[model samples]
Target: MSAEQDSVFVRNFALVIATLVGVTVLLIVIANSVFGDMDPERQALAEERAEQNLSPDFAVRLSGEPAPAIASADSGADEGGVTEVRSGEQVTQAVCIACHQGNFLNAPGIGDKAAWNERIGKGWETLTQNVADGYGNMPAQGGAASEEEIRAAIEWMVESETGLEVPES
Candidate 1:
């Protein structure tokens, strides 16, 4: 072929290759958006593989370590909540600190005057109820043992931050 024709042919071939690559990438993106992270067949295969990988004594081995102690049925444990009656400080350390200390998930930091004031104006009952019901990113009772524990934790946070008393229920 002539030089100009050869150049044209090479350019066309390059364009075709580039187009094919672009189309492949676009298809991958569309598949990810449409199919999401898990495909039913893939999930089933993964589960099967996981099961197969387990040893014959898998059940026994899994519980080899004694499970951490969960609180007893009593001690004011609410439905779908833990039984352990954790002190405000303990609860703060265990769960509240995760979000509250640094305000992760838009949580009011411990002793954030401005943040606490906004909710404090809403009244203690409303605040505690919100805690029980899981306001915003906070899971119900902030995953505390019970409503009482949740209240205590909130009170502790509020009192420490704003020096205002939140009555106990």
Candidate 2:
């Protein structure tokens, strides 16, 4: 190629290289300034960007079956779920106390931890089940009409005096 043409080509290549280098430096500087230092304005702008990117139904269910009900009358009892029972204390006082005052069936006292130590070792679930279904002299639902009454009696007896954590009904 001619010397003039070669010189022009070399100059064009150098100019292209310089322009690219300038652009790269500018991007790096812009990034460093934007990221390195934080101000309220920048923070606000980023939050705005994030908000714009987010959807109104951000927490919408994307998939999966809706969770099953914990306890419906038709659905039947929940594991460690609240039972439909109340007035347990009254029932216990009226009925259970007669037999339990003597600590029959080896069940614990009202608040005697030593007595309950073995029963508690049997676990809360077993205790609830035993009481609900009837364990020896305890009788089913403490021989009450409704499950609510049974659970209430259990909760009052176990939690109030014994310090057991009873589930809500």
Candidate 3:
């Protein structure tokens, strides 16, 4: 083929490859977004993402070692948030922090804005409402009966995850 024809062919091939790669990445992100929230405890902590990014099946096998602070799951040994509790720190400590602690719930890994953007896209109030009413794997009031407790829990989680100050209105 002529030089110009070769260049055109190469450009088209590059475009096709680039498009395919873009679609693949988008699919990966969407899949991760949809399924990353499955319970990823110390038993399976290396998870798909961690396996893809961190050590290979390392978190799952570290059973004898202490379960490090998880990304966002609470193995609440205290039966956390089962009743009316208004302490922000407590509610958060008891409840939301588990799944909200890190990237466990397709989360932004506590303080990662990029991870929270879409949730924030729904508006903070809406997000708060979801926490109050329960969304997906999360329980209502994050399993707390008290509104204040739930708000507090959400505020703590939001602040920790995004560093954004929640207003009391």
User: lDDT: which candidate is best?
Assistant: 1
Q: Write down the lDDT of every candidate, Cα atoms only.
A: 0.77, 0.67, 0.65
In candidate 2, what are the lDDT values of residues 1-169, reduced to their tens digit?
9999999999999999999999999999999997877888989999998997785435455575443346566445554444544376887787666666667776566766556655655655676677778887667663554555655665666667778564332
Q: Please, what is the TM-score per model?
A: 0.46, 0.39, 0.39
| Top model number, TM-score | 1
Better of 2 and 3 by lDDT: 2
Task: Count clashing pairs, candidate 3.
Answer: 9
Residue-wise C-alpha lDDT for candidate 3, range 58-137, written one tens digit per residue: 44755564444444343453342223345677776776667767656564455656665546556557677877787886
Colliding residue pairs in candidate 1: none
TM-score of 2: 0.39
lDDT accuracy of residue 132 in candidate 1: 80
